[model samples]
Target: MKPLDPRLLRYARGTRVYLAATVALGVVLAALIVAQATLLAHGITAVFLDGADVRTLTPTLIALATVVAGRAAVAWAQETVAVRSSAAVKSELRGRLLAHLVAVGPARGGDTGAVTTLITRGLDALDAYFARYLPQLVLAALVPAVVLARLLPADLTATMTIALTLPLIPIFMALVGLHTEAANHRQFRLLSRLSHHFLDVVAGLTTLKVFGRAGAQAATIRRISAEQRRLTMRTLRVAFLSSLVLELLATLSVALVAVGIGLRLVSGHLDLTTALLVLILAPEAYLPLRQVGAHYHASAEGLAAAEEAFAILETPVPARGAAPAPAGTIVFDDVVVRYRDRDALHLSATVEPGEIMALTGPSGCGKSTALDVLLGFVTPDHGRVTVGGVDLASVDPAAWRSTIAWVPQRPYLFAGSIRDNIALGRTPMHLPEPPTAFAHCFTGTVPDAPRPDVAAAARLAGAAGFIAGLPDGYDAALGDDGAGLSAGQRQRIALARAFLRDAPIVLLDEPTANLDTETAADVMAAIRRLAHGRTVIIAAHRPELIALADRIVDLAPQPVGAR
Candidate 1:
């Protein structure tokens, strides 16, 4: 198991002040309870039983009620602060994780697990750490020490006994905690596997139905579910056992303190009020420790998740070489990109300032990888890629990427208007503020603005007519990844986005692969229109696209070859 990472401290950065405030509130609550217990014990012995005076009992009752209310109020405040902190941390981690995943992409984070796991189960695991485990950890350290100091002068032996037992919580916690990392890792795997299989099953449900094998797939899913059930149950059993052990330890320690205090009272070593206070407040101190111990497993799981999350966040991406002074040509200098356990392919090309160069290759012929290198998505194992005469390796990726626009093989359509998706591709941070039905930004609006240019790009994509027939036109809200539209419709929208950007250099990858003929033709025409006087590199197999290329650099995978 890995040592407890100090990086967990980073999650609490935005919440540091609140964490202190929350813990302080918790201490106030603990103190209130302790004070109330002390007052009540004194009242019972000094006045109620002795019947010396009813006057003194009034102060004790008031003090007890006041402390009880203070404890309740502070407890609520602590909960509110703790939840707010957890929310802030969760928000930051999720956004950062998404951005990193988008930057690294499936081509990089491949075979690890479903992306759903990264966003869903993986992130969900951290909830306990932030929400419960972390707060308890703070309380265990702060509350116990403070509570002990108060009890020390009152009953030295009992306070010391409880104080000494505090170390056992973390010690045994560490022991059992060691084994949990592996168990959590296994659980994470099962969780991801479960999600991956679910996504695959959902995505392929149509195919399965077409082939009449949905039943078989369902059976397979059931089998996976059964395995996941077994894994989950196994984890729970371990968690239950650990909880039992911690409970047992805390129970025995507190019980021993009570017995000793009882004996001391009988022998005249302790007074009645002191003994009652010890009995009442002893469990108060022991409670948080056991709760901390119980939640140790939850924290351990979260820590394991944080490890994986950090791995993705902290990973260094392939360099986007030295930034050219301004937008310059993409130069491939005898670049040889090799995949491990696969044949290597070499590429050499210079996409000049304003001429379209289409790269054609068979599937898995390093076409996408080649584009990835130019886009600085992948760095070549050998040779150099330069833009504007400076090597890409030395360039700032953001600045270099800022100079280009890409229409990937499968462009993503977000859960918003057509305008929002296009804004993502805009250059110079300039969004076209056209007087259309929608302003191309979130806050901007163009009433009844004609999206004909948007429509034109769609027309060229063979998607114009179908969209024209839609009730909302471009104003329709598409589901994430364009769930509402056909796959061809999604591609057309993407091509329209590329057209809308009108970038100096366009790097596209088979933007019309799965579209029907008419749609593909319009999409191709849109590409031609989009490519006029721009450096365009399309990793495409279509004959129509091949005809548009001034020169075709074939990246055909071979035992050995030169293009």
Candidate 2:
């Protein structure tokens, strides 16, 4: 990323306001710096050269104190704003990033662990960029120019000297920045790899143990960790060495300006007051630039991570329409999807409303891809899908999806009470209790008073029996991704969700793929109930599941060059 990527300003609205504030503060800080230096120089010259006493120099002392306090106040204000702006910008960027990821869907969203790390720990690094580097950068641009402008009339020679040498700091910074950016990118990549690998190992630890490969996975994780440590140290070493170089250059420049001032004062070519003012302002001119160089290292990793985020956000999403979904028969008209020089799917099918249709295929023959096509996650390279002769592509995806209920082969269940997970975004179903005024009039308890709808849906999906046996029933807290539940239990919960959705169209993918015989029978029974009176599509490999369909469309893998 460049010093200030324009995409950030466009993608994160908070950045626009924050950046404007930063620039305004930079101007205020510049003015305060000049005022402080001018007052201090005059006070010192008054006391030493003019033989002024405390009583006569009281006003000068008072003005100097005021300027100092103003500078301190401005400094505090800048820090407070920086902290708040960092939080707002991160939140805005994170929100945009998550929305874009969802819009693109899972097919093209890349590795789950890598993206998880990026949105969480990855973007957190931006705090240094906003809080430290950006403020100093604004100061570097403003303070030096302000200081030089102040010195031009009082001491033209000092001003020229400062101007000519100041460029040296930035020149060296540019040179060092090129190397530092590459090193930072390398370090971030290793960290991402380490994070991804560790997450994968932990998620599969049980499977690794079953296969007697846990030791091998542990060794792999250790190797990646060691590599990450070495790269981190190396990046830090470069940052430290570059900070030293920038500091040394800035020090030499200030000293050079001081040496010229000293030479002129000795020759009586410069007055003491002017010399002192020039000396004070010269270091102030270099300080912001030097600090920018130092903070640049601190923000480098964050910039690298943001570059990836921008890349993801920039990916083109399949265009959707605003029109409502048309209802009738669903038709797949000679659809063909060619991916990576092989055909992912090719089909021609039709299903009348309220009919059950099954798509059967081998693992790589694109059964799931067919479901994705219906879900609008992927657009076919050729052919069209239509509902009652209206193009599916012309329908608003969200509106169309609202009319459909989908159960993926592996449904994701978030960490929450089971009822919340099942309800997802909708408010929990509840029956209003009798009014408080009539508290004593009821003779029997309200049937399913709290969440009658959820209970009814669970019963329809054959999940009520297991749910009632749980310690907390429907209110049981689930771990991440529905942990602490058996595979059959998870499947039942997903079916319960679909049942609750009650959409006109239902799409199920391998609904009984991993269940035991008895559990599969129960699930199949629920599936029969779910399919009745609904426009249902099932991507199935099991014979019994296929048998339940009104008709089957067998999808065989296409050979290479079969486009």
Can you give the TM-score per candidate against the true fold? Answer: 0.83, 0.90
Which digits, one per residue and each the tens of the lDDT, describe model 2 over residues 242-301? Answer: 999989998898899999999999999999989999999999999999999999999998
Cand. 2 TM to true fold: 0.90
Clashes found in each candidate (C-alpha, N, C closer than 3 A) = 16, 0
Best lDDT goes to which candidate? 2
Residues 36-146, model 1: lDDT tens digits = 878878887887468857675777778788888887787778777767776776667776765565566445654434555765566666666666766777777667777
Q: Please tell me which predicted candidate would have the highest TM-score against the true structure.
A: 2
Lowest summed lDDT window (length 10), candidate 2: 429-438
User: lDDT of model 2 at residue 433?
Assistant: 12
